[model samples]
Target chain A: MRFISQTSSDGVTEQLFTLPATSGDIPGVLWTPDGATGTRPLILVGHGGGQHKQAPGVVAQAHRLVTECGFAVAAVDAPAHGGRPRSTEHDRLIGEMRGRMQAGGDVAPVLAELHALIAGQSVPEWRAVVTALQELDHVGAGPVGYRGLSLGCALGVPFVAAEPRVRAAVLGLHGAETSAEAAARITVPVEFLVQWDDELVPRATSLALFEALGSTEKTLHANPGRHGAVPEFELDSAVRFFTRHLS
Target chain B: MRFISQTSSDGVTEQLFTLPATSGDIPGVLWTPDGATGTRPLILVGHGGGQHKQAPGVVAQAHRLVTECGFAVAAVDAPAHGGRPRSTEHDRLIGEMRGRMQAGGDVAPVLAELHALIAGQSVPEWRAVVTALQELDHVGAGPVGYRGLSLGCALGVPFVAAEPRVRAAVLGLHGAETSAEAAARITVPVEFLVQWDDELVPRATSLALFEALGSTEKTLHANPGRHGAVPEFELDSAVRFFTRHLS
Candidate 1:
């Protein structure tokens, strides 16, 4: 990965970078709390679908992890999202699927297949970013944790499932049906959040994804609201969850 | 399949029957319009998870198909649910999966594996039910169509994909991630219903399933509600869809 820019504000350093990827290059941002000397916990924050590493939610969460929780944070643009160059085929498929859905058809399989394809590409990019981070000075040597939104959950489940370095996770705002098989591979502690009345995801599917995890220690935190209405209190709870487990 | 009883009410004749199977016997209900003519469109109705063939929704839908749409309808109990004797293994797995979800772990893989196994059995049973229905005088010899609910979509996707006799389908109230490849084989017209605010299925996943269908003509009818909150008007829409395609 090559750093594109570095800026510091409010006792935190934010570095924008791009990493060579099989599909071309992956854009990302990493946040590190200022005045930190040695090893500390590293948290990966995944953004929602149609978003990127720089999305407000991702930046806010990463900022919280850095400033409040004293951790380094990293995030990457998922395929067809953010600053990453889009594939015509992917865009076409997504467009077609969305159109069909608007017309009253079931196109979930196509979306899932596309998600899996992107996830397959993203997991490696994440691994590479982590490796690049480890080479930097003043970075953490502690356990790695993950916090992902809906699209994040979709890719993060399988990514966390495959990466043994991800010791704990906070996943929510998405149903687990797409990554159920990968969920079974997650043996680490997890904090799953769900909006009881999610407009975009089904409650049973979310619960089922939680059930698919092999982790012996996992907690479900359900709140009443729509998909994007996650309570601000929950972010604090997630910070605590990672602190308790990763730190 | 052997007939157990027949009752007529509201211009519809409901027949109760049991079909021999490896698990013992599968109980089913078939609804035919009273004073029915020969060779009318036949629609196979598949119930939701945890519901019997005689569940109110299943019966009500069947009655409407028979009395209003001039179609014959049939439904059977899924293995380990309703009249079919539960397998200790199935119950144990479900219990374990549910327990894990309650503990905030992911158990979607287990549920999916179980769903696949049951779909394998249910598909054959559905085929046999159709064959048995063919021998009866009240049932029709016309084009065959399928209408499956949540669990029904889980099993029905593969069933319809494999059964060439089923010319059209109405599937939804579930995601098609588990049956994407099978969905790709369904080239007939379809009308898929989804609750935009479904608690167990995700909107994108539902759209993906619709995209996966091989059908050149498929319609999606998404209502704003929870998993079980499908509007009554959608059923009427489904009946019209099937009637236009099958009749």
Candidate 2:
């Protein structure tokens, strides 16, 4: 793990870094309270599809977690997303998905395939990142949480299922088609969100994904809106959820 | 409205009262911060079927809203429940419902019928009670919220829809069979709850009721439990919901 740049604002510090990996150097960012050190609960935030680690929503969430909960937050670029180089296979899958969506054809199968391909690489990268992040003097090994949606949720279902270090998760905006089996393996507490009228993900599939989660303590929060219109109050609710489980 | 008794505990004052109605005196209870003497948001809590105005859950929620949010809270006993006389027709429906449950038969139709019969009287009773309560000094006219579940939800749907004074509501635990039409008429913000494994209400019907709500700002919070096992966290969420809309 290597730190590339650091900045501070609004009492939250943001650090950009790169972690050496088998695939290549994985770009990532971490957020913490400004001028502070020592261990605290850390949250791993996964960005939506076509978004990078520092997307506006991701940064806003990171800042809130750091400032409100005093929690360390981190995000990493997916294999073919952000500053990562896309392989020929990645380009082919992306092209197919875009073509199908533009032509009003079914994109579920292809989307699932794309998520599966990315998850294979991203999952290991995440594991390695957690190992390194926790080793930092300022973010020692502590209970970890995950916040992800859409593409992030597609990848997160499997990651949370396999990763025992993750204590809880807030996930949604995706369907069960590609994540049900993995979802069934997750036992930690989960806070799942569903957009009642999500245009990209069918409502039944989103409900099905919530149903598939094996967590004994999972709660589903469904709001009336399109895929991107999750009300702002939900962000407040998520802060409370992580504080309850991780802090 | 006439006060029957008053008690203060833990910085909250509980007052038992009754409002003169054409049908009979409507028995109710009100809670507010001790020494409160000005207009504030008032939340009318409707008790569950077979439960009274001061049922344990109802009292706990009322206390939270009063002590934490400084809001005035009130609850009235439903007809055929909690100090209210049961008509022969009410007795017949109750008997049929209990018998069906013992025989492992479906009780949806009978329950709906019972709800419809009670709602006809309770809706107007609620309106009258609200008018009379808002006339009090501490509980002067202000934004009003409603919280109810099970039979309370069955009655609340119609009451909230018809009572324009109600600005928001937190309701669930019943299904759509009797409430869908009224739910469609409710345009205020709503926080709807659903017990995922509810033994009394079908899951699909609860989802349908949520879907039928006309409120563009409605949110559904579903947790894994039986009909009566709503998690405690939800009460906290309800407090936040009401605070956001009412205050």
Candidate 3:
């Protein structure tokens, strides 16, 4: 599919490229917003659980960030989602999502030291995703960030904290299957947008994470809505949070 | 599964009961509330597409109506949903609801018989659903109103417009699929909780129904939310809405 082009406020254009999956030759779109400031701030977006990266709502927002916000957004089409290899096991897998439940997320894995695909999150891979993002910022134009919705939100925080290059993050409509291990590791500036009333993800677990984040700079944008919510985007709040920290 | 129990203001205790479908049975629930002033306004809560009535969220809301706020709520598990019949052919026909595609939400049939559900809607089963609600209401209480979420919200309004006992309605998180159809046949008081910023249900379509409702008494309780919403339970706005209309 053709990843549409968008125009940013800085008078340059944004281009959609593909990040071929390392596991397989699957192709996922990576939207590169041009005209980024000197030392570009990278923003890598991720997919929600049980959904692909190009799901309509996610795509709309990706387009908006590239076009309206002028941010370099690498929207990952993770394994088993978007253009990556299909996950044969999820449909038949055991109940609930856990690290043990299923796998396939955009991360730099180190063990293989082989092709980027087939890599595990063996410390090195995590560093690689962050390293690549930082390099891209210098190549693309400075302060890089990360954000995700739903499952993406669940993974984005830890990934951001692990990779020092990611200055901040905006996690939206997330809270399902939160990892306390991941929670403890999140020491960077972070914000959570949760539909506390949503049933898709356990709200209590998210509240627990909110309280547990190591950073005193944490904030929670609670939308009194349901799951998979697009209506309560809280764009201004998110933009403000990112701008305050990223700048 | 178990239904929730609640106590009313006048010290009346009631149990929420679901009508089971035993091969030849109609499935529904009678959720009794307290402080009946001679006759209390009853609300027939409808389930969304391809979902059972007794799902955890539905059951919890039934409790809220019965216990927290005083309103008699009767929810039905529609055919092919909940403890209802399922056919391989019908299941295939229901289509998959994932990533912005839900099967069988068309309103062409619903508009054909603007005055009713059975003849007008594309399918006869939903009309049967309307009849089931009416029959159960008559058996359990005097008169009742209607409330539905998502697909149910789209179907319930027309059903209530035709059923006189339905004094008021709160159509949650849905709008007429087509604009021309939405323009026709609305007479009762309605509170259209239009999700002004919703991503799942496009904003334009919702605006169409809001503009079409001819009832001067109709009010719009538009929220910044999405489709998978339980209006009467989680949100304080929902509780307030029920308080004003149902009481």
Candidate 4:
């Protein structure tokens, strides 16, 4: 993993980290609070596409999980981004699968990556995230949780759905609409944050996705700020939401 | 440096690159439109503090820049952030200059970091970026511009302050008052993008800086997003702003 340690003028320090990608790499970093030293709730964070684990979606969560929520974090790189240096391997797989699909009507590459991710997810590569969460507890000084923004939301939903370990989940700028069918399967208590005036991703897209979630214990946060405002929320609600559900 | 990777189901690939800090480390990646290479103005990008170079800021920017202006870009890690990890390392020679108040009384750590970064800003870093832009130019590409959000804006303003290289500059969610001072020093035109509500740093603070710059060629973009929303412009004004200045 690559790391960037940032110290603000206020003397506060933050270390930005990037994870390496293999054939199916998830880019992200784990953030530990200062002086933290025990197993805490782990936040398996996912970032949007075109963004790596070190983007705001992941970085801001690093602070929220460590400081505000008192949890350890593991920010993972989403597909075709930060972790894999462009998911070239995935792209190649995609091409191969696409060719096969064209010939056999099967999404071979897509299924391969997602299934491998899911199969190994509970294990390293995928499952290693869970192990890392436990590690965060050992190193983070406490518990763990889950957080995702935009595309990261997509990854978190599925990961948490398959693994019942994640206590709470926060989805920002994305919703069940990313894959309504897939979203319906997720039973985790999730917090959906939306920016109504977002020009990039229409607000309705997120709203539709939120409505599609099968999870009954869900809360929606409406902020006037665009997708950029995810970090502004005290995130207390998310913490509380996760705390209520996770442990 | 640690590396992280992830890929999308469809076929998007990215690598989480952590550039180590030791003075000679420069890792910059360019997102050139499918096929193109020179003469296109290069867009030099800087991410926010604790954020990696190829983060959502740039991820979002790449999509927006390509869509709005048909431009190519080179995004890089700033000091102590992303691949190059380190807070500002104080050299006794420069650290002693802390006693010297060129900007204000005593020394502001932010300023110190900024100074260190600028002094050490390598030709290799800038040159690699320029090379990427040229590669884009080899094909048919549009004029190049610069844009930075948060700390990116902070570093960017000073970056373009004295350069005649860039055709225009777009800095968002930066301090308006300090920027006013910076704009006064810059020879090129600047379009400052500000959010309607930015809590991390007061919105008014940046507004005051904008009011201070008073550049005849200067323009301001007020949006409905937060500090992180700079990359997601809600209006067509950003495109218009860049066009007016680039041409």
Judging by DockQ against the true structure, name the best candidate: 2
The per-model lDDT (C-alpha) reads 0.82, 0.95, 0.53, 0.56
List runs of model 1 lying over 4 Å from the truth.
A1-247
After aligning candidate 4 to the native by TM-score, how far in Å is the CA of B15 from where it should be? 11
Tens-digit lDDT string for candidate 1 (B1-247): 7889989999999889998877568899889988876777789988888888999999989988998888899998899889677677788878987898789776667778889878878988988888888777767567899999788899899999988889889898777668788999989878777676687788778867876778866655555568998767557667876887787
Chain A vs. native, model 4, TM-score? 0.68
Worst 10 residues of 3 chain B by lDDT: B114-123
In the range A80-156, model 3's lDDT, one tens digit per residue, is: 45555444443323122333324543221211111112213212333454455445532343666667766676556
**Model 2, which residues run further than 4 Å from truth?**
none
CAPRI docking class of candidate 2: high
Write model 2 residue lDDT over A1-247, tens digit each, in one string. 9999999999999999999999899999999999778999999999999999999999999999999999999999999999999999999999999999999999999999999999999999999999999999889999999999999999899999999999999999999998999999999999999999999999999999999999999999999999999999899999999999999
Per-candidate TM equals 0.50, 0.99, 0.41, 0.39
**What DockQ values do the models have?**
0.01, 0.95, 0.02, 0.01
lDDT of 3 by residue, B1-247 (tens): 2344544434433444443333334555655544444344466677776667667666666666656766666676655567756656444444332211444455343332332322133123333443454454323334456667666665665566556566666675655564335435666656566554465566556656765766555544443345654333224444455666556
Q: What lDDT is reached at residue A141 by model 4? A: 27
Ordered from best to worst lDDT, the candidate numbers read 2, 1, 4, 3
lDDT of 4 by residue, B1-247 (tens): 3334433321222333334444656665555444333444446677776677677657766655544565555677765566554444434424444555554454434553554455356323554445434543342334557777677777666556645566677776766534456656665556666665575556666656555553445545454445665433222344555656665
Q: Write the per-residue lDDT of candidate 4 for residues A53-102, one digit (tens) a residue.
A: 66754566567656765566666555455645434555776567668767
